[model samples]
Target: MSAPKVTVLDYGSGNVRSVVRALEHVGAEVTLSAKSQDVLNADGLVVPGVGAFAAVMKGLKDVDALRLIGRRVAGGRPVLGICVGLQILFDEGVEHGVRTAGMGEWPGKVERLQAEVVPHMGWNTVSPPEDSVLFNGIEDERFYFVHSYGVQHWDFDVSQPMMKPPQVTWSDHGGRFIAAVENGPLSATQFHPEKSGDAGAQLLRNWIGRLGKP
Candidate 1:
């Protein structure tokens, strides 16, 4: 099969070059575009963020990406958010006592980690659920995390009889926080898979592999 067409949403949050390169290395026909057509037409969309929560939200708004992402997910198209990209998918984020509204896709808040160490940098292991496609064969592998804030809790109820529950992956820095989430067409990670080397590559591959599935 031909490489899956993936578009990396470029909204000026920075640190996107490495993400684009990583996707290309994983056999994806990647396009770094802010065009609405490009964002919605691709087989997969990647939202990469590397900055303060408020600023990232501002950038997304400037490019009209919030609506684009919502439309994609609503249509059952795939979307992957990285770092602050993941954080912005929630209800809101509080950084240094300032609260900013997020995309509100998930009902939660991103807050500063209650850890002794501020930025929880470096490699860390995660506990992915058995049905996770994102962590398929790399469950024991560690991914690179470089953030001080994350969604520390998950409160969304997926207990309806017909709907499948989301697969939540957990990791601990000062306490247990959401490391990754696989909820239908929406998936995200607090860590940077592009920078995680081989293990990260496999994780990205796993996600890319699910691009065209029904």
Candidate 2:
């Protein structure tokens, strides 16, 4: 019944500070992993992205980190991806670079926003992924978002879900990006939950509550 050990991957995305503070506030033994060793050993991991997709992927590659991350998650580690971090989980993204495949978790591609104005910033609505535990104790509402691209939707391997939920698969990362997607022990958020005020805090706290001791 003690706090969980959580690691926030700080790749210069700028939101790790608040996430770390918030997790610690919730009694989590939080560690900021800028080094590969820290990252590979984390009980739970958070991948934060605050810049362009190509650059972010390059940074992860520079350190050969995402494969290690994939290994951990594949081993049943609870992992979370936020914003751009969420987008890169797909098979590819078209931001600033050519068609580059992702870590291949979500099995989709990232693309530039269809919005006339790039960088879809501000508060936006996020639909819950039907019984998403990450949404426990939380009301469905608007969350802060600042991105030019998002997860182009993919059909979940329905045969494998512990539960099924409703979703819209737009050409743009499955119709929308919200809340978060659940694939095994992996949950990803395309919006910045850390900046979503009370709702955001509840979202994060719920996520920590769902983790197991490593």
Candidate 3:
């Protein structure tokens, strides 16, 4: 079988080349696309973002990426988000006293980590849930993180029977923040998997493998 065709949405906010290279290294036929339709039709989609929340949202909006992601995810397609890309999946983002609306795929807010030292840079280990597919064999390894803002908590309605609880991963700095989340067809990581070493490559491979199923 041919490698899964993956597209890294180019919304003018993230490390596009690095993400493309990482996905390619992990056995994906990756394309960097600025087109919304390409994102809608990809076998797997990656939204990678770096920098501020508001800025990234603006870039996504410019290309109608938020709608594309929401529509694709609602249809049960596989979508992976990285760093600020993951942050924008939440309801809103509070940065520097300003709150910007996110895509609202999940109920939560992205805020600055309440740590003495901002921008949690370098490697850190994450505690993944018992049945996480993304962390398959690399659960014990460390992943690279470089961000000050993160989703401090998860908010989901337990009353909704159809909504399965997400497989969550946690990591600590001054306090604990969401390291990764696997919710059905949607997955995200607060850390930079592309910057992470062998462990990160494995994580990407694991995600890619899922794209070939069903």
lDDT of 1 by residue, 1-214 (tens): 7999999999897889999999999999999999999999999999999989999999999999999999999999999999999999999999989999999988899999989998999999999999789998899999999999999999977777897777789999999999998999999999999999999899899999999898
lDDT leaderboard ranking: 1, 3, 2
For candidate 3, lDDT tens digit of each residue in 53-137? Answer: 9999999999988889888888888999999989998999999999999988788999999999998999999999978999999
Q: Which candidate leads the pack in lDDT?
A: 1
**lDDT to native, each model:** 0.94, 0.73, 0.92
In model 2, state the lDDT of residue 46: 86
- Model 2 misplacement above 4 A: 157-179
Worst 10 residues of 3 by lDDT: 155-164
Tell me each candidate's TM-score: 0.98, 0.85, 0.97
Residue pairs in collision within model 2: 91-102, 151-173, 152-173, 152-174, 153-173, 153-174, 169-174, 169-175, 170-174, 170-175
Clashing pairs in 3: none
Tell how far residue 105 is off in model 1, in angstroms: 1.3
| Model 2: per-residue Cα lDDT over 1-214, one tens digit each | 6668888886666677987887787677989876777776776788888787778888788767787788778788888888878888877888666777688776667877666666787887665645567776564566777787876456657775665443431222224543467666687788887788888888888888778734
Question: In terms of TM-score, which candidate is stronger, 1 or 2?
Answer: 1
Candidate 2: give its CA RMSD in angstroms: 3.4
Model 1 residue 10 CA deviation in Å:
0.6
Task: List where candidate 1 sits over 4 angstroms from the true fold.
Answer: none
Task: Supply the global lDDT for candidate 2.
Answer: 0.73
User: Which regions in candidate 3 have their CA more than 4 angstroms from the true location?
Assistant: none
